[model samples]
Target: MTGLVEYAERHPWLTDAIVVAALLGSGVLGVHLVGPGDSRPEDVWVADAVTVVACLAVFGARTHPRATVVVTTVCAVVGGGLGFLLTPLLLAPVMVALYWLAVTTTSRTAWTYGAVTIVLVVGTAVGADIDETVALRSVGPALWLVLPLVMGSRSRLRDALLDAVRARAEHAERTRDDEARLRVTEERMRIARDLHDVVAHHLAVANAQAGTAAHLLRRSPELTQKVLADLQTTTSAVMLELRDTVGVLRNGGADEDGLEPAPGLARLPELIEACASAGLTVDVEVDGEPRELPAGIDLTAYRIVQEALTNATKYSASGSASLRLGYGARLIIAVANETRPGDPGAGRPGYGIVGMRERAHAVGGDLRVSDAGGRFEVVSSLPLHTPAATP
Candidate 1:
């Protein structure tokens, strides 16, 4: 039952055919009522032929309604005086035609054709000795012809409704996709900020310590050796943190096993040694007790020192630099190098500094770079306990 209803709704042609059959059957009943009284043999034959032609017109009503109306009208005119059989059936074909015209043509055309049909049917009755009242009554019910017009109008409305629904659905899908892209863009920005914080601070501290070691080596070789050991530890710490930050990209989580911890304030001495080897003089002053920091804070401090010293290696004219690390709830690191008059690294500030700043910001830290009296300095401070803090 469900399938049948669905098919009928979708296929207007099927409904139209059913309506045509019912209308034709009604026409046959009308003829039966009018009777074949006093009809001669030849008259009966012509009447039957006309009646058959009119009923058949209903069959093609949907495809060529206007043509069917014309054929039925001609048959009505020819058989008017002869018999009522063909004349009664005329209303069926005319109604079907009007319905089709209203469906396929303008309302004006349908109304015009409807007026002509009413006039012709009425006139034939008056001229053929049939009562004018009876003829009017016979054709009045053909107003059911307007069914196709209603159906067509409704079909157009249905199509418009379906189109609107599809458009809204597409708009919703597009909105969903746009929002997803926006989320990804915000996440990348956050990650970049973390990287800057972690890198800038550590690099700065390492640069300062290395400078201290280089200066002390000329006076006390034993103290220089101790500083070198500390510098090595700082380098190891920075390398570990660097690996963690990079690992986040390769493996999408913070808690993957088999990953090494990042370097933090604990590795400051090693950082100084690496800088000393790179020909930088460094110094260290500790004001606060060394305590564990969040991974992000540790990494940020390390990166800042690394980038500052890298900048020094590239640009320091005297081949000497300074490093400072102040640890607290937050870690502060600074590295500075004197620019040589003709050093290739002095004239250009490169990606090293830019990369450093980005790392500081990632860890919720701020980085500052400046040149004073031919000395380039970088400083960054980062908070502990930031989320996604790598160890």
Candidate 2:
């Protein structure tokens, strides 16, 4: 059914031919079946000729609706004037024209055109008094004319409603695609930040251990062995983290069981030992009772302290840093390290600091980095509890 409508739309001239055939066939049949019984041969010829002209006028109905209606209505009156009964079948051609007119134009235009045709056909049949029957002269022609106009208007309305529904569905599909793209972007950024933290912290500690081992190799061989052992531990730990980070690129996402427990505040002892191996001392302080923290906040807090001390190991004049954790209504974290002369004037922060800020904001918290007069400090506050759903 859909294919046939598309074909008709593509070839309008072919559609016009089909309509002319149906209307002409019905008109000729009506003339033979319902004409006057004692009609002359010439009267039959004239009535048939008028029917042919009316059917042909339907071709122009789609493009010139008003003109086509007038022509067909005039032809209908001419046929009725010649002692022919106004049967609906004989008026099929005029009805076809009105149907096309209604479908192609607005309701007001179609109604105005249909009313004029009805008035002309009915008034002429009654005025001529050629056919005396009440139904044939007055009722039949008016009733048939109105049917096609109603059908055409109904089809037009149905088509308009279908198009609106199709447009809405397309808009919803586009919205879903946009949301999917945004989610993918956020995931990519998270993986990049994690990769940076794992690589930077481990490499800094390993490099410091390797340098310390070289300095003590000839002077004291026993001390060099312990430094080399710490180097091996740092390398092994970094390799495991690197595999986990790379697994995200291999698989679309990490499965719950495939992941190790994420790094957080519980890992601080290891971070301090690694900094100790690098010849930097980290002093830990706690205010209020220390307790378990949310996974996201814990990981963010650990990364900030690790990054601050790692910077100190590479650049601090004092070679020592301070870490303070305050557990109150909100968890407060602060890490400070002494800076060398004219070091870190705070023009633009490095990727490590940027990553730390992004992690804090991701968990609905805030972090700030400041370099004030020989000291670099990172301070952040986080909500202790997440909103839970009620059963």
Best-performing candidate as measured by TM-score = 2
Candidate lDDT (C-alpha), each: 0.66, 0.83
lDDT (Cα, tens digit) per residue for candidate 1, span 54-161: 767766766776787677666665555554543434466665566566666655666676667656665665564565456454454334434444664555456678
Per-residue CA lDDT of model 2 for 13-102, tens digit only, reads 999999899888988877776454555334888888999998998889889878888888888888877756667877887887888888
lDDT of 1: 0.66
TM value for model 2: 0.78
Clashing pairs in 2: none
Q: Per model, state how many residue pairs clash.
A: 56, 0
Please give the range of 10 consecutive residues that has the lowest summed lDDT in model 2: 33-42
By lDDT, the best candidate is 2
**Candidate 2: residue 80 Cα off by (Å):** 5.0
- Using Cα atoms with residue i matched to residue i, what is each candidate's TM-score against the true structure? 0.43, 0.78
Candidate 1, residue 311: CA error in Å? 11
Error of 2 at 294 (Å): 3.7
